[model samples]
Target: MRLDELPLLTVLIVLPLVGAAVVWALPRAARARARTVAVTVSLLELVVAVAAAGAFDTGDAGTHQLLETHPWIPAIGASYAVGVDGVALLLVLLAVVLTPLVLLAADRHQGGTGDRLQHYLALVLVLEAFMVAVFAARDVFLFYVLFEAMLVPVYFLIGAFGGPLGRWAAVKFLVFSLAGGLIMLVAVIALYLQGPGGPQGFLTDNLTGLDLPVVGERLMFLAFFLAFAIKAPMWPVHTWLPDAAQNATAGTSTLLVGVLDKVGTFGMLTLCLPLFPDASRWAAPVIIALAVVSVLYGALLAIGQQDLMRLIAYTSISHFGFIVLGIFAFTSVGVQGSALYMVNHGLSTGALFLVAGFLVARRGSQRIADFGGLQKVTPVLAGTFLVAGLSALSLPGLSTFVSEFLVLVGTFARSRPAAVVAVVGVVLAALYVLITYQRLFTGPVRDELATTRDLSVREVWVVAPLIALMVVFGFYPAPMIDLVREPSLVTLDQVGVPDVPGGTVVDRAADGGTDDGDDEGSTR
Candidate 1:
């Protein structure tokens, strides 16, 4: 078969699942071998993902590449379909790339060994497969199935392997997730019922073109948006995240916040806007308002957090607020920025969580007040923490700055008041990060902390890629920006909104001339 004809996506989704099965089948006594196998398999999956990325046609950013389809559940008009556009590909890469790092970062104390070691590894691999499938699914039904199903391994990873309150946190996470899933299920069924009634009816393209009653469309939009917002963990519905993050292992928290949580905003981008353009626009103001509130509320909460894990979780809430804000603004820069923010947030937040996990492991506590003058004993750890913290604060030299800047500028063009209010979150971010750093890493060295060691070679390897990517993308974000441009335009077109001139003008002017570069100056 030709390269494009190969079932690359299916392989990408199945490989880890198969690996999980193999890990599970191993003798329980072979926990060491199982860890090796799991890590090796994750590495192999990352290689496959990179090969797929290499083959992706970046020049044609609007179309899904390497499309694969087969008949599955014809009774429900659902087919086994998968493909990747720039947006999907980026997310897939994120999932694949993070899985291995998370596995490698796993230590015995964090529930990486024992009789359940194989089970933990298997569940992580299974979660990886579902995450890839969720991002790659071209069929709406398939997306929803994988969307809810993705929760299974995560539930186990947390409830079975997490901290003292793991089971309770897991239950809370599941309850919130299931409530959202139920709401989305109603909307999905209603949408399918309203369709022309065939296999094609379940496809995203076909569903996008459907003409439904205004009230029906709005209701469906709410169903999907509510689910996504909760997943995004927007304020009010966001309480579960702090508990979940605090209780889960750092590696688990990394995947939960970095990759899985993204599914929520991803749904908003891929499902809500395209499938219900009028409803998206109709609901933009309210969503933007909520997003702004999340930005401030999350930041304020982060500053007050006593637990390091919970603090990082709160920061994600703030970051996600910016992402949702950009998505709803309906401007080219805003949407593209949100897309890029998804990628950047994964890297930065994943690093912070992992580092925080290391600190907790060393100090035997997650409380910020437990450590003082850590820089005197473990300079490397303190330095790594500083880098990750600065990145979270959107330091200008980091990858986050570019995306966050775009989101703010884009929102400013569409709604100055919203953008202005969102900017306060930035100041709050700096306060939280610096204060946490000061509380833990600064001050006189304590005799107890003097024995604490710095990062190991393995730990360094885990964080090295994330730090490198942040710096590289910070200076040169064009490649990612180019990939996101066409998708943003397509979304703007669906929403029937022209590109806001202020965004375009500011972007162009910042680049030092009127030339529009590879995007051709068109926002749909």
Candidate 2:
């Protein structure tokens, strides 16, 4: 719990900001130099993050570690508090890991390298800083600042380097994000005004500890949930996502869909439940229904997509459905499943986007119909896409399988009908992913793409680890399971849900779970 021990979180957030500054300060002629600097900084940040994870005590994750809290705006009772339980730590690690890979992927494609590359790298680094902050911030206001601020860089990313419709996509994305952010901001203000201790104002930990009135609680909860839903891009609000992804460059699309989008669901699991337990319980069934609908709906849309990147975008909607499903299941298994799925989905889908980007860069087309017999033209590219595709489908021996299975199992314990409907999502995922593979990678070789090469050395290096980790974690998820077990249990308790005994961690009939933070002596 020493400051040095907690330096990981600090460095994870700061390094990216520093990188952004460096990128921005670079000479106009040093585009390549700027890229190099951005990559180096991100890689260093990733290393520090990994080292911190190596030192983390998984068994004692219920309680915060490397805890740092200090007065920021003391007048309003806001503080610069930051720490990580198991779930937060894991996500922090995942965000760090993906960033360098994103930089590498960006470099390999060299898509928008002239005047725009520096800005792109800077924006990405800034986004990374916000991402780490979101995972680490212990104060409600700090989290909200980071949450909403995360969108700015992405807005520039899509608008600057995306497809022919990039400008439109960026504008749409900003409008939706602004609308959600403003609503959430109003809710935050309300919470502060009415919070316990009178004028002491709001802090996440303190807010969760307060006993607000039921009606007030539900409204606050809905405010937060609506914002997260839009970010999660659930069903009705999900249209923006596909357009943004389709318009973005391969690397930007990969990072946007893979990592940034998880912020919505992450906020739900970490902030909403802890701060508004009763409201969450009351809204559980409705949220679960929406989750199932997102699953089926996202999948159907993905199945019918003619655009590869857009298809990947729709798949995220479906994947997020599982995350939402897990959150509402009110079980430790479900919660942990959702958290792990968040990380797993990032790796698998990020790789898929990377591969798709590679294809689009080579073929200069986004349409699936434009791709034909890619396996014949470039076997390595085909194989990489296959691995990413299988992982997306939650195939056995891939990272997503464990999490997706846990979500369904936990959900079934509480809502059999919802779980049954969700199962169809799994089947649909297989169809969409496999059909995409068949149509794009397995058809007759196209004359235009015959000379297209397989993944380059840097490309392989960037994605190889992701694919390997997916398989490694898929078959042996015990380490990850242990990482979030107690934190998730605490989260479930915060949501006023009972824990399931034995294999599962949710009980539908009772609100009984342990979040006493009593196990302080457990080893990593």
- Estimate TM-scores for all models: 0.95, 0.94
* Candidate 1 lowest-lDDT run of ten: 505-514
Q: What digit string (tens of lDDT, one per residue) describes model 1 on residues 1-524?
A: 66667788989999999999999888756767887899999999998888888888888876888898788888888988889889889999999989988888888867656766778888999999999999999998999999899889999999999998999999999999999999999999999999876865688877886788999999999999999988988987999999999999998999999999999999999899888877787788888889999999999999999999999999999999999999988788999999999999999999999999999999889999888999988998899899999999999999999999999989998788899999999999999999999999999988888889999999999999999999999999999988899999888887655677745433321221223444554333
Most TM-score-accurate candidate: 1
Q: Which residue ranges in model 2 land beyond 4 Å of their true spot?
A: 1-6, 107-111, 197-200, 502-524
Clashing pairs in 2: 498-512, 500-505, 500-506
For residues 168-261, write the lDDT of model 2, one tens digit per residue. Answer: 9999999998898889988898788767642235567677756788788889889998899898879888889999999988888777878888
Error of 1 at 289 (Å): 0.5
Candidate 2: what lDDT? Answer: 0.83
Against the true structure, what is every candidate's RMSD? Answer: 4.5, 4.1
lDDT of 1 at 231: 91
- Backbone collisions counted per model: 0, 3
- The global C-alpha lDDT for each of the candidates, from Candidate 1 onward, is 0.89, 0.83
lDDT at 423, model 2 = 99
lDDT of 2 at 126: 92
